[model samples]
Structures are given as structure tokens and as C-alpha cells.
Target: MSTQMIFDYVIVGAGSAGCVLANRLSAEEQNRVCLLEAGPKDRSPLISIPVGIGELLPGTRYNLHHHTTPQKHLNDRKLFWPRGRTLGGSSSINAMVYIRGNSDDYDAWEAEGNPGWGWKGLLPYFLMSEGNERGTDAHHSGYGPLSVSDLKWKTRSGHAFLRAAESLGHRPNNDFNGSQQNGVGFYQVTQRRGRRCSAATAYLHPVSSRSNLHVRTNSQVARIILRGEKATGVELLDGTKILANKEVILSAGAIQSPQLLMLSGIGDQDQLRKSGVTSQAHLPGVGKNLQDHLDIIQVVEASEAVSFSEALWPKLLTAMRLPELIFLNKGPLTSNVAEAGGFASSSLAGGNPDIQFHMTAVPTFQHGFNKRTCYGYSLHACALRPKSRGEITLDSTDPRKLPRIEPNYLSEPEDLQVMVEAFEMAQDILAQEELSRYKKKSLRPEQKLSDRESIIHYIRQHAESIYHPIGTCRMGSDELAVVDSELKVHGVDGLRVVDASIMPTLISGNTNAPVIAIAEKAAELIMQRSSRSFVKENRHTQEVE
Candidate 1:
């Protein structure tokens, strides 16, 4: 006989969003909530140590490295992508820069038919999640689940870079999450007491002992189990079946959210049939409209000798200073390398910022662990508004197998155009007198800005993802859309996808905080609906653009 203990909500993936949803949904002790993660507990010392994040990759302690099926724009190169498979999802291993994009981004979502997703609509949720070290009621809040604080370990280079950016006529803003996102400044991070404030730390750790919430690690969800047309529960990889009295929420993030959909027979029919997935819901755009921030990173040689390039690895050289950080939680270990970033536009204007910046203090082979030298700054930029879209499809019949992702990165001609423009614009920013004194240019591609074709070629050769993927299981009002405005999966009952995947378009800034806010909003929507009678969301008869 199949054993079953019903839950009010079954939240898959205990990442940043999952943790928040689980915590909030289970707050009503009467409701039964279960949060499952494929990865182990985040006990790795590297995860807490901000600088140690690099080493945490390449090993299972912090990463689940997946790859995209050869990207056409990137010379048919298969991109090696890493997602944090730990308790916090990418937040556990990410640079931890807190951002909410721009007001226009959320407004665009509202414009896209997700009525309550506008920046104004979601600002309170954003404020609620943040516990700003430098607190305020208008700009930030001091009490929140997620700890948003300034780094106690800012380097002279970090300061010099921002000062130089300001001196170069780029406006200096105190906070990116504040009134405006147009200026360069020391980035406020997701930190607590000088250590990395990963979502596992901020959301899960505090609620670990909650009996009302059942947190399961190392349990990968295969798919949402459907009972005829309603989402009844989820089937685990080990063949374990979980029954939910309420809903099965997929918080597996942008990539896996759609992957789960397709696996569970709720996806594009043609793709589903091709993969031998019997269609449960014939949604044509389950994994369509896939978007990610494609970035071109340039490394520079440090004029100053202070860089992690020389001392961060072998685990012993930096291990000597662990006590300084372990007790006080300050020093080299407490710094997430991308200490500074900004949003700006190319001289050629039309929209918000065509270009966005993410700068790291130390450079080691870009993404994962690279004990190699050549450390100064890893300056990165990606076009804020991309016309390109990609998809996530199953590699085989197995859910354990990572999906085929093709961000189709620069598919649209305009994507390359904006990126090239942003590239030249970044060159201009670095050319300023202040930055000129800090370092020498390390990697300059021969593509000059005299013509558009050459610049496109350069971008094609150099561009890689900033790892900001969203819009797979997009939320909109159309036949192709996977979910409705309330984030309920269309054609299915008792199911909701609350993650970056629900974004109809990519935001103009880092996707982390925006994702957190989405989770908070989802919790509100989920719990509120659970308590009251289910009123069918007014179906928008409009089509998706």
C-alpha cells in the first residue's frame, strides 16, 4: 500500500525562494509544508567564507555544474554553467550583490499582465526581505528575514574604482536598491555580521528546527504529480510519492522549473513528444522565452599588489587568517569579489540602461575555481534588454540529467548591437583617469568600434552568460504562457511556479533580490489563497507579446 501524509504545500527546491516560501507558508502552524532540495546541507566552510566561494565550485560542496547544448552565437561552444545545489541555491555560491533592478523592470512585468509585479507593487516585499545595516524606512528596513548589509572589508581598490567612476562623471549613488539605480557605488551586499548572508543562512537556518515545516535535503523532485488535471503532489527521484492537500510549488529556479514542467508532461507538445514525455498539458511555451544576462568579462592587471590572485588558494595560505574571520567575521574571507556594480546606458539612448556592470576585485579564470594568477579586476557587462530567447529541454528521459539550455544568447541582431555598444561604452568608463591609475588593461580584443560588424564579431567571440537566467516558465496571459498572472500554472490546478522562471522578461539588474521579492510575493499570494475560497483569477483574454 502507498503511504501518504498530506501537506498543505509541497515546495520543491530549498533555494533562496524555496526557503522563503516554505518559511512563510508554514508560518500558519495549521498548514503542513515540506521543502525539498537535491543538494546536501550547506555546512561547507567555503560557502560562509565569501572569498572561499570560488574553491567551493569544481567540488560537490557548493556547486551543481550544468552545461548548455552548444550556443550558436558563442561559436557553437557549450557553456559550462554552475548553479548552487546547496540549501540556498545560487545565493549560497553567488557574489551576493543585492539588487532589485529598476522601477521600470517591475513596471514592465505589470505591463506584461502580471498586474501586481510592478516595482511599486513589489517594493514593500523587497523592503520586507531586506535588513539593511544602514537602515531606513523609506529606502530600506532593519527587520527582515534576509540580511542586507554593507561589507566591513572594503578594499582600497573597491573604493578607488567607485571614486574613479564618480570622478569620471558617472553619478555616485549611496544605494542601488534605493531611489535610483543609475549610479556607481560600493554595492550593498547580502551579508550578516561581515560573513556571506546566503539565503540558507538568512531564511533556512533560522527556521531549521521548525516542526511545522519539514525540510528535506538531498531529495530531488522529478516532477509534479498530477491527478487528472490538478497538481496533487510531486514524485521524488527515489520513486517516493508525496501527497499535498494544497499545492506543489516548483521553486527549482529558471532552468529547472521548466525542466520539471516538461518532465511532468506539462510542456510544449512537440518537444515533449520528441523526448518521449507524454503530454499532460499541451503548453507550447513551457520552456520558451528563456532569457539570461549574457556578459563579456575583461580582466585587468593590478597596479597595486593587493589581490587574491596570489594568496587565496592551496587552502593553507589563506587558512592562517581564518580565525580573524571566524570570530570577528572580517578580513579576506568576508568579501564577495564583485564588490561593486552599476547600471548605465550607452551614449546612444532609447530605453533604460542598455548596459549593466558587475566588477569583481580579484580575477581567477572568471566563473569557478581558478588558482591561476592575473588578478586585478574582472570587469563584466551585459545588455539589460535582450531580444534573444532560449529554451530548456530534457537531454533524455531522466530528470537527474541536466537539461539542454541554449540561451540563443545573441540570436537577435539588436542584442549584439547593444552589447557591442555597451562594450565600447565600458571601454570609455575604464579609460577614465582614475581607473587608468589603478591598473593596466589585460585583455583587449582587437575588435574596434569603427563598424558594427566587427564589434558584433568581438562580442560573439568574447561574450558568456552572467548566469542571470529567467523567463522559462513565463507568466503572462496567452495560450503559450505556462502560468497566469497569479503565477498559477495554466491548465493545471494546485500548482504554482514562483522563481526567476516566472519573469516574462529579464530585469535590468542582478536577478537575486528580484527573485527573493518574487518569492515573498508568491508566499503572500499562495497563503492568502490557501486561507480564503479560491476565486478563479480573471483570465486576461489578451495575447503574449
Candidate 2:
């Protein structure tokens, strides 16, 4: 009673990269493409409004609600990791900051044996995928699928944050993705008008009418269908088979991509056997090299009513803003809460900014799950690149079971030291005269951090992830690398990973923009390869005729 379907290209996961692949690969009329998503359709109003991230992050409706295994270094705390499950994936639930990490971050990837991934090589792809409101430039594009625009409404505290940083000798940078990345400024967001412009909205939705492409929602893949060393397609948990006539692309993010590989008998032999699954590829690096940005927030009470606390506004006032948000697309709802932030170099940095900041005009605790009743602002500082590495491993052979995620934060001594420096620098910026007018008292640390020991103690107690995780299925020439520079799975033919998981190392800033760019390059590579194959097949046919 199992069903069977086939396509030229089968993309697993309708996420940021999957949506782009579906759009590009299906552009050729002859090529049939199928995109499978395990979650529901992204039809919620909360997903469209920019500020709805507050409601999205706290629940499981649109989020995967994944959590990490206990960290041995950070007092054995299990951190919450929420990933978007709907059509847009994390792009639907994210804050929509349009930051491309430091240019050196990509160059370092090339230095680590990944050839065309350097900033010089990838910049074109970034430009191709962007549609900036600021119009065209050497570094930006005004005619791409993804919309990048300035927030229509920014909180008053956001303006004070930038001025405070500038007062502390940091230059004011209008564009973080410009000539230099060192300074304070408002962040550009992935929005069009006042609504969120996720990869689904930008790339997939417009092309959904194409006859060559088929999108399947609520289709949770159990495992890839492998014939010997090659991936043929995938099987759903409900006993249905989806066959890929050409190739199978995994864009299921960092955590699940490798899990799918392992479930399909293509991972470490020992681990597969332990998990009660047979091994086919014996690739030891299947789920290794996990990296994420560890962030710590400094919350201070504001003397005035500048924060986004609901307690400050009357119920009638909140209800009246609905028409402004819907009809005019202008109101407080337009604000992408993590509105203004900047990059800074810690004392331990080597030229490029080692720390990134996210200044929110709201006092958010535990990823905004705990609602606050007071007025306060928060300053988030995270290490751009961390030495600490963690992993994702299978808990059971069943795909329904979630993977074991151990971020292993602050395991490296240097990582802890860098965090200490980042904390001190954030404290300094918050104490600046421009922000002193609004500051009333510190909230999180609850005491003055006078020295290194106190700062270290505070970091371990308060630090959490800013939700940028990568490198689970890294791309490199090393033996531990799961994918090559071309993004093909090393030992498996017709199988590739084209998401943030393939990043050889973590980038310097927010990851969403970089992930979209990665997908853009991947589509081009796939098409070129397909074109060459078509030419060869036609030549053989003509010769035989």
C-alpha cells in the first residue's frame, strides 16, 4: 500500500536553501523537481508580520523546539535551540537580520582547502540573491529575489544604542556589508514593505505555479533510498517512496542533514551499529565539527518608556494599531526587534571584528520566552568565531526521534577568555554617556562585574546561543570533511548537501544571508553540471543514430 513518485531532482527540506533550489532547478521546463517539507504550510499571520518572532520563538507551532544535551562546561545546562519547521524554515521564524559575516571568514574557508568559497568568489552569488532597497552598487544588487530593506520603524532605544557606541570611539557605519565592517549602526532586515520576506516568499511562492515543480508538505522523510553507494531518492515514514531520477539534495539544515545521512546507512560504522543501523559509507565525519555563536545579554532597566515591554502600553492602544499594520504597513509591528546592532573588535581579535552586537529595545530573557513586566533594554554580545566544537548524533534509528545535540560551549579555555572580553566591552558601551540618560540599573548580572573572575562567572551563568549553528556536515579537503568544495557527499554519488551545514567554518555574523547566497551558488553549479551531462547524452544519441 505504499505510493511511489519520481522527479529529476528531489530536494529534502523546504528551508532557505531548498526553496531556492526548487525555484532554480525547475526553471528548465524539462527538469522535474520535488521539494519535501516535514512541517505544515507557512500560512500563519504571525509569520508575515516582522515583529511576530516574539510569538513564534516561544512555541512549537512553527518551531522545531529542539534542545541540546547538557553542556559539561556551562554548569551542565541544556540550552533551547528553536528551528523553524514550516515552508520558510528558520527564515520564517528568525529576526530577519540581513548580515553577511566578515569577508575574512570566507577567505579562511578557501585557505582551509575550499576553493571557490572565498569572499572574492562568493560575492557575486550574494549580489545575485539580494534585492536591496538602497539600489545597486559594486557590493549590492537592487534586482534580486531576496528583499533587503531598512526597518520602517525603529525603537527610540535603538537610536541611543548606536550613539552610545559612537560616543565610545566606534565609528558609525551606515552599511555593515560595505567597505569596512567595524562600527555601530542599524541592521538591514529581510523584509519587503513591512512584511517578512523569507526564502519561501522571495523564491518559492512566485514559482509555485510551475508545472515542472511539485511541493509536498507534511512529508517527513524516514531515510534516503540508497542503491549501494549512490542515493536514488528517499522514503517517507508513512511507507511512501520518492525516487530521484538525477540527484538528491539535502538542505535540511545542520542538525538534520547528517541525521538523514546516518539514518540512510551513510555514517560512522561504529555509531551506526550502536544506533542499531547498518553502515554503508562509514564516513566518520558525518555529524562532526558542530559550531554555533554563544551569546550573552546585558539587560539594564530604562528610566523612560523606551523598551517594547507590553506592560508600558494600554490594552486599547495595542488593539488600535492593527489597522495601521494591515492597511498602511506602518506601525510598531514593522520593527524587527533586534533592530540596531554593530560589530566590534575585542582585545583578542586579529584585525577583523571578533565580537558582534545585537541591541534590543526589549528585555528578553531565555530567547524571549519569559515575558517581562518592566521597562528595560538588552545588549547581546556573541563571539563571532569560537574554538569550541560540538556535535549531533542519532538517539535512535527512528527518524521521528530527535538528534542528540551537544554544543559543548566554552570547552576551550580561549573561548571562555574571549567571552570575558566581549562581556567587558559590552559593559563599557552600555555605560557610555549617550545611553546613560536612559539607563537606570543593571538587571541580568544583578551586580557590578569588577574583574575577570566576576565577568567569567557572569558569562557562564548567563550565556546562550544567538541561533547561528553550522559545520555539522563540513565542506573541505580534510578526511573529516563530509562534503567537497562542490558540495557533493564524498563517497556517495548523486547526493549533495547545500545548506549552512556544508560551511567549512562559522562565518563572522548572522548566517541567514550567507545561507541564501550559498544556495544561489549551488543552483548555478548544479545547472552547469546538468548542462554538460545533457550535451554528452545528446552527442552519444546522435552518433548511435
Judged by TM-score, which candidate is best?
2
- Pull out the clashing pairs in model 2: none
Candidate 2 ranges with C-alpha deviation above 4 Å: 312-316, 529-545
lDDT of each: 0.79, 0.89
TM-score of each: 0.92, 0.96
lDDT of 2 by residue, 1-545 (tens): 89999899999999999999999899889999999999999999899988888889997888998889988877778898989899989999999999999899999999999998999888977877888999889889776789999888888799999888888888999899999999989999999988999999999999999999999999999999999989999999999999999999999999999999999988888999999999989889989999999998999888887867757463246546878888887788887889998888877788899899999878888887888877789999999889989888999888999999988899888888788888887898888888878988888878668888888878877789899989999998778899999899999999999999999889999999999989988987888744334334434543575
For residues 1-545, could you state the per-residue lDDT of candidate 1 as single tens digits? 54455788899898889988887787678988989999998887778778876676556656888878888878887776778898999998888888888788789889878888787778878876777778656878666768888876876667767766787677988787777778887788898877888888887888778788998899898888898999999988887888899889999998889999899999988889999999999899898899888888766677765455655353466568788887887877788877877878865446666678877777645465554455476668888878888888888879988888878888897887778877776666666666668775555453235576776776777687777889998989988788898899999999999999999998888888988888888888876653112111111111121
Leading candidate by lDDT? 2
What's the CA RMSD for each of the models? 6.0, 5.2
Q: What lDDT score is found at residue 65 in candidate 1?
A: 83
Once model 2 is optimally superposed onto the true structure by TM-score, how far is the C-alpha of residue 387 displaced, in angstroms?
Answer: 1.0
